[model samples]
Target chain A: MMQEIILGDYDLIPDTIPSEGELHLRVKPIDMVTYWRRCGAVANFIANFYRNPQDEIYHLNENLISTTFNELIENAAKYSTKRDSDIDISLKLYNTILKMEVENICSQKHMEAFQKSMEKIIDSDNDELDNFYLNKIEAKHAGDKDSGIGLLMLKKDYSLQLSAKITPIEGEVYRVSVHAYYNMSVE
Target chain B: MELKAGESILKYNSADQTVTIEGSMRLANLMEYDKVSVFLNDAATQASDKLTLDMTKLNFLNSSGITTLSMFILATKKRQNPKLNILGTALFAWQEKSLKNFNKLWNEVEISIQ
Candidate 1:
């Protein structure tokens, strides 16, 4: 599969897939913006991998795709400043939903706060998310830039199932992955 | 304008009566403009009663930027202190499209497209 969509230095095209039907993207920070600009490259690669005989196309809304992926890269750039720190985006189709996961190397302390923010955003309903967004804005007045609202906005806007996991890499490097499930079955 | 530097490249522009912000406000670091937010708290500030924003260079703004811009406009109306004039100059065709797309969410704000 590697030979099919050979991975490039900056981006990996649909290049072949693994036996488990997972598509991997070896993404760089600079290519992150272009990666987002070309929406559905992730989901499309997955759909092709799973090869659903139904010939399904995951038509992710432009706005939703742009917002979620932008957040992913923004966080990647925010955290991955150290050597060999890069963002890894993986796509897996579990059931009817397409799972989009973005992992980056960041400070361990920031991971705890990032996880807490994800949990709060995942648990929040529309009204709760709205209130949280507004409260964060108000907090800005007190010199508190609650960056968590970016995660909350994803929850409020797309209403996707979101989560994060922290993994320790070689040489004491840390990895934080944020995942969001998009329902490809939606009409 | 009150320009406060964010962690790195991010800058928050508050009310400053003297300086003038020309051209489009582009959050050059990230493709998503939403990461940038504008806050207008006090009723009596040096900022424009009716502010004119030049979107000549603003390519794309994310949800956060949109929400923040909306709040700035809301604050302008709620306080009713001065007319918050929102204006944009589209440098590229896409800029015009973005302003049009975002303009819908900002019905409450008095905005003009140039």
Candidate 2:
């Protein structure tokens, strides 16, 4: 699966496998605007796929999924160096946990920033997350915001276990794959 | 003033001092948010006593758009003119969680989610 899709060729084709409690789709958005729209479409699909009468978070599920997916897609599109590179996205469901991974080629600077944000979010407690988020919002008021805005919200607001992995694809070029894990029921 | 494209709409009624935003808002970039800020600033200047934003139908708002909106609210809060009131009719789960954060910007900023 990896060799055929990632190593050989990926032509913006979306793939899916229907499971008792799982669904997967993939897309390589052409540009920033398309990426944003694609994320919404994927999020909407996942939310509805999991919609059920017995679920307590029916109303909140779709929004949360879409928002979190948007953040990931936005980050992938914003930091990627290879606009032509494939933005390989996959969604997997294991019971109530929904995991999303978006892999794309990015500049070294983008990799560094992702690593830094992951560290801060990992080390900070809930109270610190609250204070830090408010501080960033205040910075927005000052027109001095940073890339950590979306990163922080993924952990603090959406309660996603966010992490980043960087593999050297070539000189000064890195394949950065961002992973987000969410407990749909916990929300 | 009104701006609509695709599934999004941002309308400002100078007479009632109300701004209604619907559908998704992922404006081209922060530069576009600056244009939105200018529109809101002008609308605020003409407001009678308050500015109410109906965002129930607004589905998705990217990080940049969120920041732009926070800046808008903060600027209005500083003016101390039209009272900042947000009618968050957002039924989406994200809106309920995200919109509440705006109250943290200004204690005086009233947010009613119906």
Candidate 3:
């Protein structure tokens, strides 16, 4: 049974129930302004959702939400190919861990390098990560079309996994999904 | 770049080594690396022995913005400036942490968060 939840431009999957809450954000060049606005909106929404009086499962902090959305929007802006392409965003709270998945359209080559960069960044803390970001920015050397560490940093700091694959739908339109996790250790 | 807020227009004087980032020092359209590199190059070219970042009405700044500020601090340190002053009023918590973070890299860049 698939659930349906619609918020903003996204049509949430399995739109039947809220067993595990979810939010879907559609990404398009036209919605660039709204996309950034929704990034903050989703961050605050996650904070409020977990801080509910009725729920005692997981504690979602503001920094985690902010970091998650910041990375998500960065990826969305970088990967969304079409002017009106929608980026699918969904968050699931499973037991003590919260999983966030952001999917959009991009090439597989971009996903590979993005994954490697993310692992390296996640392995370091604030100081090292800052240096790495600076080095990359200074290098100014990337593939002809690269998304850089936008996806990688998210998964690294937030324990994210980008399940990037070419989903061939309607001839040659491919979709990519990037997932990030927030667990008990995230403080 | 000129950004219009409520009643004032935020300006970045590329030639003067002074950028008045008001309202939100954070720009959504800019990526972290791109912003840092641009600021560093600009600071290197425009600034002299002293670099002044006039953040009077800045209410919000993200991690990238922090990185940009740190880069400015780093550039001044590389140049061995006598006084790398970051003057501002009413800075956000992130900005304070960013200043502290920069202190770790270049201790002499005096930051006053009023």
| CA error at residue B112 for candidate 2, angstroms | 1.0
Considering only chain A, what is the TM-score of each predicted structure? 0.66, 0.76, 0.62
Question: How high a TM-score does candidate 1 get?
Answer: 0.57
Looking at model 2, how many pairs of residues clash? 0
| lDDT, residue A28, candidate 2 | 59
> Which candidate achieves the best TM-score against the true structure?
2
List, residue by residue over B1-114, the lDDT tens digit for candidate 3. Answer: 554532223565666656576654334533533544564456555556555666656655554455445555565666686355666653343343344455566767667787
Residues B1-114 of candidate 1 have per-residue lDDT tens digits of 244223113222444322223332323232243333332333225455544454434434544455455555555555665555455554333233334433443454445566
**What are the candidates' individual DockQ scores?**
0.13, 0.46, 0.18
Question: How close is every model to the real structure, measured as TM-score?
Answer: 0.57, 0.84, 0.59
Report, for every candidate in turn, its global Cα lDDT versus the true structure. 0.51, 0.71, 0.53
* iRMSD in angstroms, per model: 7.1, 2.3, 5.3
In model 3, the runs with Cα more than 4 Å from the true position are: A1-20, A27-29, A33-49, A53-58, A108-131, A140-173, B1-26, B31-67, B82-114
* Residue ranges of candidate 2 with Cα displaced over 4 Å: A1-24, A33-36, A52-60, A145-148
Q: Best candidate per DockQ, number?
A: 2
RMSD per model, one decimal: 10.5, 6.1, 7.9
Error of 1 at B108 (Å): 5.2
Q: Please write out the lDDT profile of model 1 over residues A36-143, one tens digit for every residue.
A: 433234423433455544555544344344446656656675556463556677766554556667778766566556766766776778777766766775565445
